[model samples]
Target: MDQTQSSSKALTLARHVLRVEADAVAALADRLDGAFDEAVALILARRGRVIVSGIGKSGHIGRKIASTLASTGTPAYFVHPAEAIHGDLGMIQRDDALIALSNSGESAELLTIVPIIKRQGAKLIAMTGNAASSLAREADVHLDAGVTQEACPLNLAPTASTTAALALGDALAVALLDARGFSANDFARSHPGGTLGRRLLTHVRDVMRSGDDVPSVTPEASVAEAILEISRGGIGMTVVVSAERRVVGVFTDGDLRRAFAQDIDLRRARLADVMTPRPRTLAPDRLAVEAVEMMEHFKINQLPVVDDAGTLVGALNMHDLFQAKVI
Candidate 1:
């Protein structure tokens, strides 16, 4: 065939594959019945983690399903069915739930361990195409992930079937997440290295500049002195405090530029006279993302971090949050 004809044929085949897979997932939505509910209930009632076992392409899907379940408040882990027969079966507890995936419902590796799990009183949830298959008939709950046709031209590869299985697994995880009232904070705890984790888990005190790093001066200090502090601290702002160390006002680089525009004398002017009084501040326990939001809203860069009594304990700027990778 010519190059143009070959490219055209490839694109047509790709589109057809996508349509078949999409249809397979759509069909699963209708096939979801009371068995899905029973499967979810069984997993929820268990006091132990879920054990997922499968072989081949189903095993790859099983690993992803296990990860989604684990990250979404449902405790689960995947174990190879072949390994389950060779001492890995010890990982399954009597009260734990089992989700086994096999398109044919006849994987010898899966069959060899199902009986052992059943004798231990573990709840079994089967994902298979054939309801009459041995694994489906023996399972406590059966989720049908059958596809009418494979995306492959020969109808042999596990394409549409795997897509349906993955979608079904995601549905289960999301449903359980809603049922358990899992919050973003809870999710962050499970993914501490991710951006979501940094945003949700990192707090103001954790990233704020504390101790002498915070630029501060008494309200009686001159604008030149505050200017020196701002320059030395490199946070673009200096906090003016009362005799008791309570934050009273703030002087910033913007203030200096405005002062220079008005021809004000920095050496003689007191910061208390020119500084912004009662500037917005954040509690040290607040989330770093909250600080970012406040800065964005107020069009400011630095935020004074105070304790419960409004005493300046730390200071943070856009740079600090950015450096902490929390911005």
Candidate 2:
């Protein structure tokens, strides 16, 4: 009856919703049989784009599935079922593939277009709760998205069925992605405006400080010089390079702290004496996320990016990765 009690009840209900939806998704994994394989083959064999259509709540799920397919190299778009009946059916072509969603597999709007779609010679893939329904029998491939029960308290709602359809759609997208050897870079292209795309597609050259901004010292420079470069560059580390400007090693904050712990003399010691030998470096063209992983794996905060011949071209730090959303 109190405010805290009401908040707690809402949280509990939200948790239950998540758990039920997760269970609905897990059930689909177990139900992946020959039908799934046949549907996948149907999509892969099509030389044209996939045209997805559905009505009502199924329409929203269809749109999302279409987006996922597009971003993952499947090339798809959603066509509203009612809209299709009003001349939007021209969006489909003979070489294209059509995926229809109808829980009962007998949506009037969807059924009316099925004959027309077949007459156009486009392959039809049906996802529905009833495998014996008209849409399923007419489809070149039928994927049963049946759920035993609804997660909704009232059985009239489409909760569990929609969750099942969404999960099955994701499975198809990922399977086709793998089959096509879709790379992280490939996914990034479709999502270039987002953080994930920046992380996956951005290269060390894109985020790293280059030319005069890169901090460095020769083998003969004193530890004091290394500290000055580290401070001036504000990256907490400096690359040690040979006379040809090839990166030979690096000195970092951790190295300085540990050296002081060992009673090493910064006032008189050369950078070569305290520098880490062959410190890990990234290529200028390496993905920024790859740099994040390497840094995290080695527990380092900064890296020197080099060219093919090992000459230091740029410098990058955890801050750079954070700014680029690679973290």
Candidate 3:
């Protein structure tokens, strides 16, 4: 009961728990076999969603697994086991697949519904620590999620078992993702409001300011006239175009400052003399994220957008992309 003795005991318990959980997850690699494939096959073949359910800690893990499957191009959702028996069994359909979690495989609430799910012609996939237990034996496919020992010293808590189940769930998700050739674009579509979705789906045309919003000047345009266009457009830069309206170069505020440093007469100088030649431009078809990358890499804030023939079509600044969430 002394302070030092209490602290020492707690530290020892913590170390033992960490070691046990780590071993639980590490053992999962060797446990991978055809059952994982059978589970994926059941899910990939389903016309309806994957219905995940469990109780307590297993329920928490089931919800996360359902979300991962849903966001990764597999349609899935979670249903509470107790709720399923109370008219929630209607949630199960002939085309859907069910994934149930139970470390003991004998949770009365879960066992109560396995027959009902099978009766409805829905396939049940069980993730359990005991293969011979009721839920596992009844499942169309049973995944072994056994742990060598619980992290609890008395060996009766769900700690290591839950870790094993979560890892196995992730393995199933990733395997299906690869098998289906689910790409980043597919993930982004399911997550359109998320940052990754914005980065992947935004095209230059979606964010680039067009028509009267663009700053443009003729190659014959005077430096003073180009400055007026840039100032009017408020992009801190102007696209210098030829008589045919094709972009030949770009002039910015820095170009004007350099002109001032050299004592060049703004009224007399032409834009070509002060413009940066071979200025970078993006096609409207390019991803807006690429535009952000170009701006960051070249250290420029404003860029001209051009057509396949290199004619000036539009202009954009960093602010435009930021507002569109492409940055």
Candidate 2 lDDT, 1-327, residue by residue in tens: 899999999888778777777887788788879988888888899899999999998899999999999999999999998999899999999989999999999999999999999998999999999999999999999998988777776767899899999888999999999999999879888899988788877888889999889889997999988999999899999899999999999999988998999999788999898999898999989888889899889999999999899999999999988887777
Q: Assess the local accuracy of residue 222 in candidate 3 as a C-alpha lDDT between 0 and 100.
A: 91
lDDT (10s digit) by residue, model 1, range 1-327: 899999999999999999999999999998799988898899999999998889999999999999999999999999999998888999999999999999999989999999999999998999998788999999999999999999999999999999999999999999999888999999999999999999999999999999999999998998879989998888999998888889999999888888888888777899987898999999989999999999999999999998888899999999999999997
lDDT comparison, 1 vs 3, better candidate: 1
Candidate whose lDDT is highest: 1
Ordered from best to worst TM-score, the candidate numbers read 1, 3, 2
CA RMSD of each candidate after superposition: 1.2, 3.6, 2.3
- List runs of model 2 lying over 4 Å from the truth: 1-32, 222-226, 251-277
Total colliding residue pairs, candidate 3: 0
> Residue 248 in candidate 2 has what lDDT?
93
- Writing each residue's lDDT as its tens digit, candidate 3 over 138-232 gives 99999999998999888987899998999989988899899889999999999999999999999999988889888888777898788889889
Q: Estimate each model's TM-score.
A: 0.97, 0.83, 0.91
Best by TM-score: 1
Which one wins by TM-score: 1 or 3? 1
Give the runs in model 1 whose Cα sits over 4 Å from its true position. Answer: none
